[model samples]
Target: MKYLGIDFGIKRVGLAVSDETGKMVFPLKTIHRSTRENLFLELLNIVEQKGIEAIVLGLPLRPDGEKSLTCRQAENFMHSLGRRTSLPIYTVNEAYTSLEAEEILSGKGIRGKKQKESLDQAAAMIILESFLECIPYERGLK
Candidate 1:
């Protein structure tokens, strides 16, 4: 099954997708959040275009695991997205994913504005990877 991973932000949203086998993940693209409706439409289009079967959404949490305002916003986004799509949606804690993404980018010699532009997509990849690690994959089905 193909999966879509999302790292939601107030200003920008990051996206990633898993291969048909669900063993390999790739950074898709970053969508600038100009408006909620526009973002949702674009996401829906990607889901249809990519044959995405499920969604893994990153839910921001405080370091201590408490829900913050951003977490609430993520939940709201999840709810809105759920209403729009019938596909299953799952949330995973996204603590430090951005920092991890930055480190990965820095290792690749990406910095400054370039790094900032790609950070969310990299983070989404991390979030999706974490989810893939937890799920049990069968031989014939992903």
Candidate 2:
């Protein structure tokens, strides 16, 4: 099933999408936070337009795997998002995804403040990529 992966933040939400086969996840775009209604409506538009069958939210947990304040906030956001869309939503542990993204971009010489700004997209990609790796089909059914 096609899936939309979201890296949610208070200020901006990074988005990614999986192909129908769910083998690859591609960075879509980032959306600035808005009124609850507006955010949900916009996301719904993308879901419908893209034929998204499911949603995966990235949960920013602490390094030791503990839920932090941000985790609670993400839980609330996920609940609200599900309420608005009535679609199945899943979450993947997002510890260090941002840092990992930063390291990757830095390796490519994406430097300075610009690299920081790209973290959201990179984190979203990491989140989706991790989930992608777990799929049996994607990993040769191993």
Candidate 3:
């Protein structure tokens, strides 16, 4: 099944998608957030177009696994999103996703403007890839 992963941030929202086989994950696009309603509408359109069967949201948590004000904000966003779609929504601990993305880009020689532009989407890709890796274990746990 295809999946959509969201790296929701205050300024930009990053999106990533998995192939129909659910094995390969890739950065899709970054949505510049001007308004909350518009962000939701954009997500709805992408979900429809991508045939996303599920959503994995990157829940930004503290190193100690505590939810901060930002995390609470994201929770509210997720709840609002739940009302819009029947697809299963899941959250993954996304503590250092952005840092990892930065490191990955730097290793590949991406810097400055290019790195900044691609960072969020790369983080979303990491979030989605992490979620996909846990699927088998998650299913077994079920």
Candidate 4:
């Protein structure tokens, strides 16, 4: 089943998608949040257009695994998204995904504004990859 991975932020949201086999993932794009309603509408459109079967959303937890304000925000986003779509939604703890993303960008020599623009997308990829590792493709089929 194809899956959509999301790294939610207050200002910008990152998206990634898995192939039909769910073995490979790729960064899709980042959506700039203008309004909550518009963000949901755009996400819904992507869900339909991509034929996404499930959603994996990054839950931003503190390094110590405590829920922060951002974590609560992510939870709210998850609930709101669940209400909008019938697909199953899953959450992965996104503790250092952003830092990891930054490292990746730095290695690729993507710096400054350009790196900032792509940081979320890379984070989304990491979040999706983490989920994929936890549940292998064959296991996910059942």
Candidate 5:
């Protein structure tokens, strides 16, 4: 089952998609927040065009595993999003995905504005990669 991974923010949401085999993930794009309808419409287009089977979201929890304001906001977004689709929604802990993503970009010599543009999508890919590594294959989670 192919999956769409999301790193959702108020101003921007990062997107990633698993290959058809669900074994590899790649960064898709970042969507600037306009309205909820527009956001969902874009996602729906991706879902239809890409044959997405599920969605995995990043929950921006604190390093200590406590729920921060951002975490709460993510939680709310998840619940609100649940109403828009029947496909399962799963969340992974996204404590330092952004930092890791930045490091990845630096290692690859991607800098300045390019790094800023790709950061969120890279984070979504990291989140998806982590989830793919952790879950059992028989469950079709990856």
Candidate 6:
């Protein structure tokens, strides 16, 4: 089954996807929060086109491993997304995924604000990849 991964943020949401085998994850796009309604429509289109069966959302938690205001916000967003799609939604702890993305990009010589924007999508890719690694492929099938 194919899966969509969301890295939710205040200003943008990064997207990543897994292949049919659910073994490979790839960065897809970033949707600006200001245009999220449109973003949802676009994502719906992708779901239909790609035969997506599930969604994996990155749940941001505080450093102490507690849910924060930001985590609540992400939860609300996930609930809304669930209402809009028939696919099953799942969450994974996403602490420091963005920092990891930044480090990876920096090592590759990427710099500045532009790199930060790309990091958003990169982080989503990392989140999805990790989530994919943890779950057995057979379990993903409904």
lDDT of 3 at 114: 94
lDDT digits (tens) for residues 53-140 of candidate 4: 9999999888788999999999999999999999999999998899999999999999999999999999999999999888855467
Estimate the lDDT of model 5.
0.91
The TM-score between candidate 6 and the true structure equals 0.89
Residue 97 in model 6: lDDT: 93
lDDT string, candidate 5, 31-100, tens digits = 9999988998999899889999999999988878899898898888888878988889999999889899
Scored by lDDT, the top model is: 1
Best-to-worst order by lDDT is 1, 4, 3, 5, 6, 2
- Please tell me which predicted candidate would have the highest TM-score against the true structure: 3
Q: Quote model 4's TM-score.
A: 0.94
Clashes of 2: 0
lDDT of 1 by residue, 1-142 (tens): 8999999999999999999988899999999999999999999999999999999999989989899998899999999999999999999999889999999999999999999999999999999999988887533444
The 10 consecutive residues of candidate 4 with the worst lDDT sum are 133-142
lDDT of 1: 0.96
The C-alpha RMSD of each candidate to the native structure, in angstroms, is 2.4, 2.1, 1.6, 2.1, 2.2, 2.8
lDDT (0-100) at residue 97 of candidate 2? 83
Clashes of each: 0, 0, 0, 0, 0, 0
Q: Which residue runs does candidate 2 get wrong by more than 4 Å?
A: 137-140
Q: Which ten residues in a row have the lowest lDDT in candidate 3?
A: 133-142
- lDDT per residue for candidate 2 within 1-142, as digits (tens), equals 8889888888888888999998888888888887777778888999999999988889988878889988898899899887788778988999888789889999999989888677787888888888877878655888
* Model 1 steric clash pairs: none
RMSD of 2: 2.1
> Could you tell me which 10 consecutive residues in candidate 2 have the lowest summed lDDT?
130-139
Q: Please provide TM-scores, in order, for all candidate models, with all chains considered together.
A: 0.94, 0.89, 0.96, 0.94, 0.93, 0.89
Local lDDT at 89 for model 2: 91
What is candidate 6's lDDT per residue for 10-38, written digit by digit as tens? 88888999999888888888888667687
